[model samples]
Target chain A: MHPIAEPSLLLNTSICKANITKMAARIRGWQGDFRPHFKTHQSAKIGQWFRDAGVERITVSSFKMAHYFAQHGWKDITVALTCTPIHTAAINQLAATINLNILIEDVASIQALEDHLENPVGVFIKADTGYNRTGIDAEDFITLKKILAHLKDTKKLIFIGFLTHAGNTYHARNMAQIKKVVDPALEKMLALKTFLRKEFPLMELSWGDTPSCSIYNDFYGINEYRPGNFVFYDYTQVQIGSCSMNDVAVCMAAPVLATHPQRNEIVVHAGAIHLSKEYIQLPNGNISYGKVVKINHALEWDTHDIIGEVKSLSQEHGVISANKKIFAHIQPGDILGIIPVHSCLTAHLMKHFLTTEGNFIEMMK
Target chain B: MHPIAEPSLLLNTSICKANITKMAARIRGWQGDFRPHFKTHQSAKIGQWFRDAGVERITVSSFKMAHYFAQHGWKDITVALTCTPIHTAAINQLAATINLNILIEDVASIQALEDHLENPVGVFIKADTGYNRTGIDAEDFITLKKILAHLKDTKKLIFIGFLTHAGNTYHARNMAQIKKVVDPALEKMLALKTFLRKEFPLMELSWGDTPSCSIYNDFYGINEYRPGNFVFYDYTQVQIGSCSMNDVAVCMAAPVLATHPQRNEIVVHAGAIHLSKEYIQLPNGNISYGKVVKINHALEWDTHDIIGEVKSLSQEHGVISANKKIFAHIQPGDILGIIPVHSCLTAHLMKHFLTTEGNFIEMMK
Candidate 1:
């Protein structure tokens, strides 16, 4: 019943609910609007858990996801990733029904929305505070002004505020390094918010990134919070000092296929197709695809006792370097719990989750 | 219609058919049973294309895949990965209907199959000739004898021959390096076959690995050939000299989201969830997630003109470092074709394929 004879993504509901409640209260304490991102756990049932925790608005990364949550009755939905012209049809459809928001960085995107959108929709100028992944640079006021001017002429598009996902915090090694990324990002975002406030007084400041939201308490100038990964934190967050290992709510229960005790290795059925190829480089210079822990009698992983690390992965096989104690005690049929390096990718690959209570939660397949 | 307003896995059916024909003819020339592994494409329609090329039997990586191909009229099927007890239910079900073969390396796995299998199934001893990923070592005769003895006592398991996957050939840089890995693997496999043939005459020799099968011509003693990646040769295959870039049959049609001319980068809507996180290291010490090529008027990629490389990927965004010419020509709504690093992982992540002729090909979900 636990491992289910195949690779299963196990979700601890108690831990997940606690995570949602804590983050909701923290954002409330900062006096900011809590619009938690739903990209991590794309499930309607999990969304209800957030609803129970007083979260009304949520963020997603794609138009498909926006349409999914919209169908499931999420009213205030933001497609957090930048908008392209190709998704205009979806944008128009979602905007027709829900309180939809989309991100825009340039005049081209705004022009696309104006050209095709039939219903009014909220727009957030995606600003690159520091992470150079996407979004317009916060200091690039020329482009920002041009986008804003174009949005001003549009009848169907409403400019909301500046939104930035400081994803650079993911690369931070510790709390101090996370602060190093967050402090400048906050400054740039705050500066942009101040500049835009003269014209749009109600323009909100949206900050998202799990590390900054989980580690730093001071959300001084931010009006909205949108951290996604805090719901089911993983080994990467623990490495970044965003959360402890105990806070991770998901684990991959994989069946042991074969063991090479001479090589101190055990092969599991779960591989890149199950847990994803995301890995973490340890301080000792070893790469860990995932951390292995034991499943207790209650079907929960013993986070206090990490038994091994997944060393390598092929398409459908994971090679784990087990400790002497576990390797000696393990057999080919035993199920071992593997805490994935990145929970979002793992959850996406898995497509659904199995709660510890033996209930299946469906995602947006 | 080309990009379809979202990331689509574009399969060039002509190139794919040509790859199948060429590989089928080469294996015929070597007088080996061509049971091409269907794990790469996983599509039933693509399996029909193999039937068109005169391939009767097939190889898969899992029990689920075996069930899928068996449903589509494949009679002789082999699940090439090591068998575990947890999958005995699927094994028994498949074996009861089709001529199913399962891989076994240890006595424990054999015992599991022996205890639960209701119908007689063919069993192949997976030998670790050189790749230490899984399977029994070729030199471990004592353990092999024990496993054979356990199988001898079983009523429902028929002993097939030895099989090995020389996956080490994937790490080879050139033909010479590939030969270096293949020669030792074949020698050890032949040695094991020779030693076992004294007791079990007419035992077949099965060998599978895309790199060795694509590069080396000589399959002297191998009775079966199982190469999966040749169906959709990827960037990693090109780097490993398994196939040229022109032979690659699939490309990800990703919609361009934004262009950062200041940074010489263009971000596309496809990311790890669409294209997978597998990467290749260039000779210059830079990492390449995928190679970028322009989509031509025929809805196929211009493989000759390598335009850029996907420098990095996040959850739903791939940042491509494009050349000046392509960058200038590219816009926010344009579609760029990306040849993935590993086609199997990419295909798995994509879930289905859209043929160049505007046809949707379904895979096993």
Candidate 2:
């Protein structure tokens, strides 16, 4: 069979290793344990890299993912989702196999779990801080008291403290602003934990999300940290100051398929299927889906190696302009490195990964 | 298993069959043979719906996809990509197995294919009528003519006239405007076919894409039509006037896992994994990643009802809220139907399929 290489994806393992090492150091410096969220990487091989770096505890989004990782010998896992009755059986199966932790935000969900679960699963009450998307209000200590009282009455649930994902940090303009939002939110959670202790007396606060944990070092009352995307930082994290542009290790390497001279555009085989159609609005008001990092035969990233701008994209083609000085050097046979706006979506679309040094890594199971 | 009766996908097979029947009739009425593209639905079982509706030919984006459908008894297929030297062996294998038609725009690519293959294969010259991404420009007809002449002398390639996808129709404001852009571009291809017939006679003039084929009906000179997304219309198709809001059959149904009363937002279990993060900019200048469809009695999908708007989406949750009237009725117990902005990505993400009547139909295999 001929090599199916047109719309192939390339992952920079060197950069990926560096990002993980850097994140490991950052979390260690903050005096916090790093439980990297595997939802961003999804690959067990990539997860193995973290495991080699002494990361035993991990976080996943679904029960299926938990099972997948558990089979791969990941001992401690927190299924980072609100416990659902639909997924209770899977959760039960996973908990029966390993140290599985789950998140619950509602008393009704806790009651359902209390009725059906075979074993006591470690439950973390999802706190709704200022982000205000999932958790119950922290001021409503009565609600927490009611759930804790019910769990205590049933004797079927184990409280592993509280967990909160300060997702609002993603909306911040800069690191200082992200700190301004997250610090107060963390403080609010600490106060809520203190109030909840009046009823349960033994609770911990577990805070996650790469934006808050990657940028800030002060983990005052937070017991555990779960930052996933730091393993493969992208344009968004660079712009947010969570990582430098040089630290962004993984990029979707796509081929220049066809060139359009009439519109001064070159169509790359990479489109939404390879590099997801996620756009980043730069500080200079430039809205680009991705940034071209470097071309082929280059070791380090060329900062000015902005080969082309994506003008339009379809399922199979990314239309880039060849009007830049770099474009004159980039031929149709050249490979272009692109920093995806969102690494999660890009990782999902790919089936395999090609490293910078030409090692082929299979991403799909 | 607790039935997991959250907002889950429910495909109406009868509705899907009827939609295919309607599309086939429209293509026949327009005097074009229906060669439905399978990228949108990506299910061999669903492709059978088109075959049952009298579709004999098909188109796919990649050779792997071509092999995928070919195994399902599809004979006539076109790998709708710019033919490259790297994939010539796989193309030959597929062509040997089925009546595979390949697309090539560059002269060097065609020459490379000519040098590699001994078996006769049908080749369609992909022309850039307006969408300046992949195809050779119409202004470059002299170059195309030279390439065609060279291929004809070899007597191995069967010239199948011109084929163009008016992808610019995707960016058009409305259906009428999309037709205005497509009609002229299609006419240009017909003109190319007419001009080429004197030197090298050709049989077919192919055109496709949901925006052009689904929205407009005037394919007078076009011989074969290919459209995939008509089976599962998305927010993009709804905006382009290809399908009505009711005609959209597939939706990501997710249960409200948590609600924050203070922030007036609720988080659903469905996120980028279930429904892709493809956003649609509404006419009012408000951009939402997806629209909330109707929920059923089982909190699945209802044919006649829908509620709320998805305000923001994260990796594993969709934050939805409407006005006070909408929020007052919404609770943590309810399920919300979310119609994705992009059907292809969303459908691919959902590796499993469930029918409206609750048959667990496996589509990915």
Candidate 3:
């Protein structure tokens, strides 16, 4: 509802707060620590909403983000990615002021962290529970033992627990598929915890992925949850059965630049630079960049009134393929709300958000 | 490269200057105005490079960028995207000081601009040659005549020319295919120009697409050329045969965070945020977010020594699928250079550039 002239990220605060409240209550009901990932919104102002929901600990993707939130009073922080030794200075500075935790996968990284760290930091052995993107394979016990044995000699590094991001759930198309992808990943993490309990009896288990966290009620023995994207469930999450369209809190308000009635398409000011190039393959063998929704004069959108889909994008242009019913009502100066395929990337690209109540939320640059 | 602890954009200034010189000379050889699009780099310091090559006019995609460049002394500027009525205030302010031009495709937009204009501004009729993204179709003479007739009643709008961005050339896999996509688009533009000359004899023709401009020696009858990405050709351009690997002036210097020897992969700090999530599909049915190049002790990469390819990307992590040789040499502390798939999006994401010579070039935020 803000007076936006250009492509702007519109955040529905009520919906965002409800999402946080529901997730926080669910995690508390399961007796798990909810160190929700702050990488999705990257706004210190939005961090206050999580704090209102009784979340104190947080997870960030980068050292810079950790520092940003630390400056905003987030004391307990975890950097979820593998910590490279090149950021030794940043690690030492951040660890000196807060309860800093970093993920480590290989013995080499553990050794590198131990050699350069000037302050103590919690280390989580990143376990690969099927998302083969990064982290130590759950079945690779040799590397785990080596990392544990090497950490035994370290002065600054404190082994905390095992952590896994079942990112493969992002590829799931339905609730059953999501469960199929996550059940095995959780089993692997639990198995690894059991195997390592002989030497590391106090170790905790950390598992988080938006789909699995949103769908399942019980987390078995996992001690902590760190899902980020659930805060702003997008078109992709809706497609993956992680969350419903009603839970989506963020939408892009883009101005229509031109309309091509013959082609049944309208070009908007939003593009890859605004919404990100992430896309989903539709059932009709077409790729959709985002789903378009009608914006009322009050500048609010209804999730159920899905009008069209963004068929293509360039540097600063998004072409939405629309049907005659909706296309007839659209004009060059009209504004349309688009639910991005991936809200995390969209938030990152927009760098800020305008709440529906006309307040601007500043994010880390 | 410049003591980077995070993913950083690295610019080879020599290669960038060479790209500018070559493109300027070729445009001059064809007697066309070289208004290189500043949206690729969006840096005032880099704009100096174009000015040094005798380029006074420039093209940008947004009003914010047009204002930025105008402040930096760029007098002749064309906002290459369709102008919306919502930005009338910005348009009036910008056009009040500079020789500003905006693209218009329909009579509605022209009416909106005319009704809101407080200063004189040049207008170009956007013609959709083949991209089918925006603009009036070249064969849609009825609409063209209607727009021209409507513009005749305008007080502050000055008709400039017809402009077309043959973006279809981006999908071309080779130089021949590039020509195949551009030749007909050029013919359509020429035919439209000849027909429009009956009433608008002094109208100009502006055509721009990096692939077409870089591959073709002659831009017959086109009065102006505005190729933006040719300044920093990317992996997509190389695959499109617009330029060779040597022409790519920018590379992302990302810190290696973890190495998975069993999977022959390494995780880097460069991810979707750093690389813009633009990818090219390889012939082997694999998607490459970027091509990995070896960075020596001097932080210089040899185009011929491509070490691997970025197979997947998350928010802040890039998974490089490497061979045993490259995987064996990589460590958590090392820094690797990744040539991005699309330089424009990458440059936009990285707000500044660190030249190989260690100087930071600031861009418009």
Candidate 4:
């Protein structure tokens, strides 16, 4: 197929294997357990890559996703989101077979899990060190103490450790800024562990976020790692200095629908529906949806190769402001590769993927 | 079976039927052809409703969508996007069977169509009245003359009329701004039509944009009207004064996973991936992704009745900022209805829909 007049998400497995290998080597040097979050890819075939890279455990966002991957031979998993009462049955069903871990924030969630669970599952108290989206405030040890006391009575719950995600690191501008978020969060995790060690003696700390996990080499206070986006680091991570340009494994290949030589722009078929609406604010203050790249006949891209920037996007149209030289080569029936701003959302919107070797990879919806 | 942890796109048929009836009645009195855009709903079952309401024609955004509706008994359709060289085989395949109309913007597109088209397909020259997204500049009669000269030599093309969409009406703040965009576009359209009609005496004009078609009652110079988002107008249309709150037919029913009563916020499972990440700024300067409405036991929402606003969103989490009174009642296992900021993109993001009557409607992918 031409892949023009439509958008196709192209995956380079060779680059993806390199990314996986790089992350696996980093975790091995850190001497910590590698449990990459499966929410980023949500594909059984990609999960197999991690398994082959010696990643024994995994993390997912939903119990339904946990079920989907468990069916594909993932024996250990963590439903990373807050376990709610609505997911009681699905959680209990998965807990019966796998070494499932669930995040518990409030005592009510603990009570619901205690009343409904069929088998014992490891429970981690979600602590909010900084990015206060959700979770128990790390400063409020009283709430954690109460939840821990309540967990003592539950037969089906094993109070294991604390979990936190430095999602604020996504907004960091550089290396100094990323460590400003990672250092404090690690300090808070160790502080929380120190207080709990007096009572329980053995408590693990699990920190998961791509920026911190990719930049920081030392995980001295952390026990387990669960960074998802490193498998296909996007332009966001690249801008924040979390990963270099070579780490990005996925890019959108959209067909050129029209070329405006006077405007020096190329109109591509990929829009917000194909590439997600999330954008990266360049240092020059220009908002870019994605970075345009030239693809060879084999659909391989050199990320450092400068082409153009996707300037604006609407529902089904992406306007690329390229130079006259770049615009001269493109016509109505050409496909231009775009390194997406955020790979996770783009991959999710594109439910199916085509590998460079001409294979279709289907993700769990 | 329980849609508590995943986002569910909920459709209220009564409200949708009312919207369909209102548009159909308005178009009947206009004395022009009513070709409703099927890109909003994308469901064969919803197309049946338009068929039942006496809509003899339709407009779709892509050739694949046209093929879907053509299979479902849509005989008259306009593929309203720019027809590129890559879509020749599919367009010819479609033109062979139905009264297909495709948009042509440049002379290059015309020559390509002239070469590859197997059967005659009606062609509309896309004219830029106001929105300069795609189309020939309406004032550039030189390009139109060249295209017409080229079309005269073609064998398998029918030069029908000028087509346009006043897409800038979406960014209007009020009715006055909408009219500011609508009136001039109509003036230029008439000017273009008058210039073209001197040679082609039976020339027509086609205009389609939800705001323009909904607010303006006069279609004196237009022979065809094609509006899509009026089928399920969202908060953006409501903000622009094209439709009231009562006119919106579709709202997303998302699950409440957690609540922060102290902060007066609720964490929802619906996020940018589910709701398409489109936002509408409130009068108070707060950004809202969607309007929250109370859901009854049957998951139906009264469009006028709103409880709170979805304040912010990440990839998998939407934070709803509500009052203490609203937060006091919600728990971890509740479903809330959200009237999306943009219905067209939201509907396209959700692959399927569930009506209030518990019927599942599958859209064309």
What is the lDDT for A199 in model 1? 94
Model 1 per-residue lDDT tens digits across residues B25-69: 999999889999999999999999999999999999888888889
TM-score of chain B of each: 0.97, 0.93, 0.98, 0.96
Candidate 1 local lDDT, residue B80: 85
Q: Give the per-residue lDDT digits (tens) of candidate 3, residues B1-365.
A: 35779998999999999999999999999999998999999999999999999999999999989999999999999999787778788889999899999988877778888998999999998998988888888888888889999988898889988999999998899878888888889898899779878888989999888898897875688999999999999999999988999989999998998887777888899999999889999989899999999877666778888778999999999999987887667788789899999999999999999888888899998
Q: For each candidate, what's the DockQ?
A: 0.80, 0.54, 0.82, 0.64
> In candidate 1, which residue pairs get closer than 3 Å at backbone N, Cα or C atoms, i.e. clash?
none
lDDT of 3 by residue, A1-365 (tens): 45667999999899899999989988998999999999999999999999999999999999999999999999999998788777788899999999999998777777887898988999998988889888888888887888889988998999999999999998999988988888888889889888878888999999888988888865798999999999988999999987888899999999999987777888999999999999999989899999999877666788878778999889899999987777667888789999999999999999999888877899998
Candidate 2 retains true contacts at a fraction of 0.47
**lDDT per model vs. reference:** 0.90, 0.75, 0.90, 0.85
lDDT of 1 by residue, A227-252 (tens): 99999999999999989999999999
Q: What is the interface RMSD of candidate 3, in Å?
A: 1.3
Best by DockQ: 3
Sorted on DockQ, highest at the top, how do the candidates line up? 3, 1, 4, 2
Every prediction: chain A TM-score: 0.98, 0.93, 0.98, 0.97
